[model samples]
Target chain A: MKRVLIAAALSTTALTATSAAAQTEIEFWHDKTGRLGELLKEQVATFNGMQSDYVVVESQKGNYSEVLNAGIAAFRAGEQPDILLVFEVGTATMMAAEGAIKPVYEVMAEAGADFDADGFIGAVKGYYTTNDGQMLSMPYNSSTPVLWVNRDKLQEAGINPDVDLSTWQNVGDVLDQLKAAGVDCPMTTAWQSWVHLENLSAYHDVPFATKENGFSGTDTELAFNGPVQVQHISTMGEWARDGKFIYAGRRNEGGANFRGGDCALFTESSAGYAGINAEAKFEFEVRPLPYWEGVDGAPMNTIIGGASLWVLAGQTDEEYKGVAEFLNFLSSPEIQAKWHQDTGYLPITSAAGDLTREQGFYDENPGTDIAVIQMTANQPTANSKGLRLGSFDQIRGIIDEELEAVWSGDKTAQAALDSAAERGNALLRRFEQATR
Target chain B: MEKRVRFKGLWLPLLLVMPQLLITAVFFFYPAGQAIWQSLFIPDPFGLSMRYVGLGNFEFLLSDPFYRASFVTTAVFSILVTLVSMGVALYLAVLADRLIKGSGTYRTLLIWPYAVAPAVAGVLWLFMFNTRVGVVTWYLGVLGYDWNHVLNQGEAMGLVVVASAWGRISYNFLFFLAGLQAIPRSVIEAAAIDGARFWTRFRTIVFPLLSPTTFFLLVVNIVYAFFETFGVIHTITSGGPQQATTILVYKVYADGFVGQDLGSSAAQSVILLVIVGILTIIQFKYIERRVHY
Candidate 1:
């Protein structure tokens, strides 16, 4: 009789636990920490409060590459989350994993959620879309490279803080003056390959790779060793030799130097504004990225960096419905505008941009709209639409090595770029084979 | 007379050793077999499909100049790390053994670094040597010396090597100290009464007595330098400035995890395993002859 009573009690407890969890749970794994992480949690709480049928549980994985690796491993083990945030470079890898992901368009359509494909900015949307205009991932925090200026440093060098630096020629003059004035670090850049090679080709309206930068097919060849690219790299190499340019690292290690008021000029992502605003003690300004004056159709459009949200496969239908709803909530104009104003990431949708402008965010923060204007100044050419190539992360490593050789005066610009192209092409061919 | 305990039956002996055999099979053999099998094929990102390439992965790696250069880099790195770490540990152990008072405090302070994880050790070193904001870099600048390891291959390699060897000295010190304490003191006292100085006595008596510990440490340190030290290389240099410090193990991690090229990484591990096997055989065959025990 006592055993029967204990079994009944256990059954009652299990039933209550199941009943309390009636809301369908959707798991979201992202690579954000600190302030961004806290903001994401707040957004999730607001969403859960507004709804009754679903709850989104968000988790912070490691950095970009780590998150991609973890997602792939989880998929293989049949334990993947419902949503993952993959970096821009991993687009090709994710797209190739057909059965591993559920495209955002299909998820939105099947769930009948309010998603507008046309609402997104062209350059931002084009990066994560198929050739047929179907969206693959939900565009999130997109950012473009811009030039950051230390106004006090410029003034200390007896130069105007508002000097025109629209052209590389003008920037070169400034660099020479800064060097002459005994500035140790006149100019330094983060994301060397992205800013100097990939986006430089896009801004100059030249091909970075064949087959429309790998949008049409997988058999694309690297063309970044062209004369224009070589000329640009040669100029930078000369600057390095003269101590006018500092190469801190392959990634954003230069951010600290720039924020510490050591560098007069910095070329970094627009997303750097958050950290610089928080840490920099001196006044600073944001300016459009400079382009060479001689190139035709120059300063065309810069490509996007940062990441997007991708829905994974193998979740229950109810879970996918919750994912679609949460994504819709995130892309709403109020939410997106708030995120853009808080984090300095691009407002991905037109409505969000308009809402931000109407709310006086751009007026209050001068020079913050440079990235948007730079990206939307002209229709993106075939080259400016951004890259879609497999093994891009590895190719970037090769580029970094070659660029370092040039910076250290071990190799000429043309020689280093040629070698980089050769090595990068070999990897591309290997990727082509592996996917085939 | 020799005393031995004999098992009653084969079943009892086999049963007694079953747990160890099972653990070895599960932990070592299973993963090794997986690596060997996976080395022959390239799988898709989702692992939904695998394409067999036979010896193609090996062929690619062998032909790649970067991969070939890593072999030399790994050799140089392992040799330098083993020599520096072991040499320093032996010297410190000798000093500590000679201490008549406060030896325990000195020994405890020396052993503290061994408790730090390799990655944490790497981060600490990186902070002190950071180019833009490092304290050491600032001090060097005040002395009219410029230090930028990001673009300097030699400096990057030196920094990573020093950091890798720094944490390992404590581990080697423990063994050397134990070996020194185990040595009988009567022989040394006799040598002293015979008018032998400290250096002469150490060279003729104590040095030979510590040969077994040195030999054991030599083998272990080589293995440690080869397979471990990935964290230090990763955090400090990341195999950068033209792949100057791209050791073999770091390459395995970069390719397999970051690059998602599993087949090549697996093939490289197989080659590494074979190389280590050959090295162990050589050490046992030739180097063992000089060891006293």
Candidate 2:
């Protein structure tokens, strides 16, 4: 009797929900919550309202990493979503997978969707593009690293809040002054491995890894233990030992330190704009990430972060078309422009950047366009482009471990980096063998 | 009569037992067996990579430096947290027993943390230890303690221990409270009247009765600290200002999922399983005997 009643209730619930309506439903799963998640929902709602022939249902799967995991797990179970949002680090891993994903360009072309390949910003597009210019994933919220200055703290430290901080040498001097001025937390950072080793390598025009940072081939090895990376790490170690640079835990724990107005200076993502704007009562400024003084091409553009939307394989053609329409809508210049202006992630397209500029938004905000400028300042070198190695996420954990040792005064900068490269490369070999 | 007995007793019992055995085989044994197989064969989840590595993965783990550190950290954390929480839980349980009127109310509030998800517990403890915005940090600063986990190793260790303990305190409270309630009050009262002080009373009177509960909690708290505390550790520390907090499970997650290094991750998982298994055996062989009933 109970089982029969449960079956009747389930049928009633299903009838109340869908009523067997045929609207070509497409599942769009993401990892954004809070303001970002709300924004995503709003976009989906707009798309859904614009048409009756198709329904684009966007759902919050989890956080960035969790969503990726869920996507992969679902794909294995043959229940993958039509669209999946993936962060930059997972790009190489996804790309390395043979049949788990369908390239975005193919999906766009298959749907006969109106997509101008040239419309995407080169830096943003290049990260997700193949060697022959085939787009792999749609860039949704790409951000580059920049120095976040708590202007109030610097001013209180008796230093000029607007002083040029484009070079590490100058930043070091300023840190010393801040320390002398009784600032306990002069500097902290988010994504130390990224900002320190990654953009650090790019800014200096040096390779972080061979085989084009694992893009051209899986046989890539860590080149970060070379002189440039070692020097930067050693300098940071010196600062850490001197109490000038506080070592917050991995991820963005130090972001709290920065946003709380305790830390005088921070190196973090440009997309941190929303949080800092909301929580901080102190004056803050965004500047280009500091590069080492005297390095050739020391101020080259940094790589992109944030995340992108990936259309998974194993979906029906009609669902693929909906995904295409959704991607195209998301790519529209007005949509892109407004998203960039509001969220502080880079405008993914040239037209969006132009629109943002024409609206006088960049000029009005002063530092709002700095992320764009830093990313598009110069042609990217082999080193300046994004890393795309299999097992990169594991490799980053190894890097985190080594970097921590340096912070704790257990190992010197060179030693820590040497250990990281050696350990990271062994995993690289294992990954290479697996992929081969 | 024989046919009736076979149909009623043996066949019916077999039918009733089938579902549980099937579930165990499918859910638990299946994945574990696959992990062991995958570790030896070294198949990438991506399907683009597969290799016969044999025991190469294990050999790599044995030689890895961070492997040693993670194993040590997990062992140390599990051992210390189990001992500390057990002691604290027993003490609190005795105190609750003394409160004849408000015992239920105290028990309810005491096990409140048990209702919180591990991730939530981690976040709450993180709020307390946040160097910039934390209540504990403010007090620690006032007391002139070096309280920054981001900069200090000792402080980082303290933060991990605090977070680990807070997450399990709820379960411990529940377990200990139940054990104390089951203990007959006449024994404790007799010891008290025989001129026993609080400590002496606890040692000679109520202690023997609570042994079974203590045994259960010892195993439980050990498993929790080893397996369950990773959520808190991952969120609060991500294992360090350096690698100070990277335990076995953290490395496993980082390697298998984050790094997408399936082989190495599997090896790490195997090691974790072995360690926990050994601990379980030790508890059963050595500790279970002490239980009074």
Query: Largest TM-score belongs to which candidate?
Result: 1
Report clashes for each candidate as comma-separated counts. 0, 5
Docking category of candidate 1: medium
Lowest-sum lDDT 10-residue window in model 1 chain A: A1-10
lDDT of 1 by residue, A1-436 (tens): 2243355557678775454367677888899899989888999999999998887778888999999998999999998989999999999889888899999999999999989999999999999999999999998889999999999999999999999999989999999999999999999999999999999999999999999999988899999999989999999999999999999999999999999999999999999989999999999999999999989889799999989999999998888899999999999999999988988899999999999999999999998888989998898889999999888999999999999999999999999999998988887887787788
Best by DockQ: 1
Q: How accurate is candidate 2 locally (lDDT)?
A: 0.83
DockQ (C-alpha based) per candidate is 0.79, 0.49
Off by over 4 Å in 1: A1-20, B1-13, B193-196
Model 2 iRMSD vs. native:
2.2
CA lDDT of every candidate:
0.91, 0.83
TM-scores for chain A over all candidates: 0.96, 0.95
